[model samples]
Target: MMMITTGRMLRCVSLVSMVIFAVLVNECSSQHTVWDPVHASIKNDIAQGVELNAWCKSKNTDFGHHRIAYGDEFVWTFKINFWNTTLYWCKMWWTDVDGKYTEGSYAIYKAERDWDECQNECHYSVRRDGIYQNNYASDVSDLVYPWPK
Candidate 1:
């Protein structure tokens, strides 16, 4: 009768809806996840890591965790060959949700230094611009210092 037909129609609709829902769930489960973009860090090396001068904000690589290895002074040391290592950069600062950079107190306000110029100071420079490795002695290379603006 009418009641039997109504019940069968309802069952058919329920089965169809369940099949659609299951398919949707399976499709979503098989989809891949997306990654966010890399950002830079703001930190510096003064004496220790006073405020923040140099920083690196990047996506962590699958093979290695990202790190900004540097110091305010020369207190921090490099584990690898100093020339191939990250020894000169530190972190900088950003303000609010909008990402405005607020220069921090830790920064020496000094310019970015060439490898040679830094070598002349209390620190070690990986690539000596003017100095040559012949056997023993070397000459003082003209230094050109670069600062962050």
Candidate 2:
């Protein structure tokens, strides 16, 4: 029969205590660790010679208005907020080939909805019908918003 001596028990308790303390310290420090930045790209997929006007912003940052030519794209990168509440949205408009004006507003990224799906990168293709979205983690694209007729 193996009996634990008082000294042996004390040493084991000390080792366990040290491991718990180390784990706690690591958990606390991770809250302040810098997060990797997320990239967003918006591409124009309208008809040839058509230009898409886009203005995008977050609560604290605004990317000035841009005119994106067909086949061109506008891109930006930003780090997620410490609170994990980061969000970005855009207002877009363009004149169709028939001279009809179309416009829309959309939330391009919401941390709660995109954190798992986007996994750090988001892509948008603005088409004559709507906006299509693709993410870093998947090749599949989905139309998330449509232009207002």
Candidate 3:
């Protein structure tokens, strides 16, 4: 006959509990953790008479070209890649008052760079002078890219 004393039973329980906890911790620390999607928006804050043309893309996605009117915005949502190297960039162009085309390319969402700065939502304001990123902490839009001549 096999017998288990109270102390022996308690030790078995403790060992089983420890193994379960270890498994849970391992799963939680794995690279397959569910990542929440991030939202990025670009608004045409240019002059009322002008329209902004933009084409945005990432390594895995292309948002296509779009013509945005004054005060309108283009928005996209995506999940950060498993390796955390996700990045999105845009090429933009618009006609100036002088009948010249101004163009530029800028990074919109870079996981490592924006993960802390954007806090899951990134906003950009485009103007004749430059493209600016909206800083939530200061309520200011800082220029990130300038219009190319």
Candidate 4:
């Protein structure tokens, strides 16, 4: 049987430690800072052009839009910076018959490392009877409704 030497054993340990260190560094660097744009679609059927606005609220930041026209189908995208596990709320609104903005619908998401848990696409429609529907999409799930009242 061959005898093991102390220097060789030490070198083997050093190599294993270095490999572990490299793997940790790679994992830390691979944590991505995602600036993802959420796609939104608004279908208007009130017989008039209505202003649309979409936004999201997070712990430290609120991001979204001001005033956009909802003609036929209003489509827009808003960007959000996702980094940690945070509760985010997204809301959309349109101008009513009295020219006042009303909260049409909203969605709440608990975002984790992957934003796939949250909604990546939002679809809203205003019926001729002044009713609205809120729909959202995700990778793991399909269209969901009535989120947390």
C-alpha lDDT score of every prediction, in listed order: 0.31, 0.86, 0.84, 0.54
Q: Estimate each model's TM-score.
A: 0.21, 0.75, 0.74, 0.37
- Residue 103 displacement (Å), model 1: 5.8
Which ranges of candidate 3 are over 4 A from the true structure?
A: 1-34
Q: Rank the candidates by TM-score, best first.
A: 2, 3, 4, 1
In every candidate, how many clashes are there? 30, 0, 0, 0
Which has the greatest TM-score?
2
Candidate 4 minimal-lDDT segment of 10 residues:
140-149
Which candidate, 1 or 2, would have the higher TM-score against the true structure? 2
RMSD of each: 19.9, 7.1, 6.3, 8.4
- lDDT by residue (1-149, candidate 4, tens digit) is 99889999999999999999998896687433234456655555544665656565666667666554555565655555444465556576666667765664444444452254335564555443443434323223333433222
The best-first sequence of candidates by lDDT reads 2, 3, 4, 1
- Cα RMSD of predicted structure 1: 19.9
Residue 130 of model 4, lDDT score = 41
Over the full model, what C-alpha lDDT does candidate 2 score relative to the true structure? Answer: 0.86
Candidate number with the higher TM-score (1 or 4): 4
**How accurate locally is residue 135 in candidate 4, as Cα lDDT from 0 to 100?**
33
Error (Å) of candidate 3 at residue 2 is 19
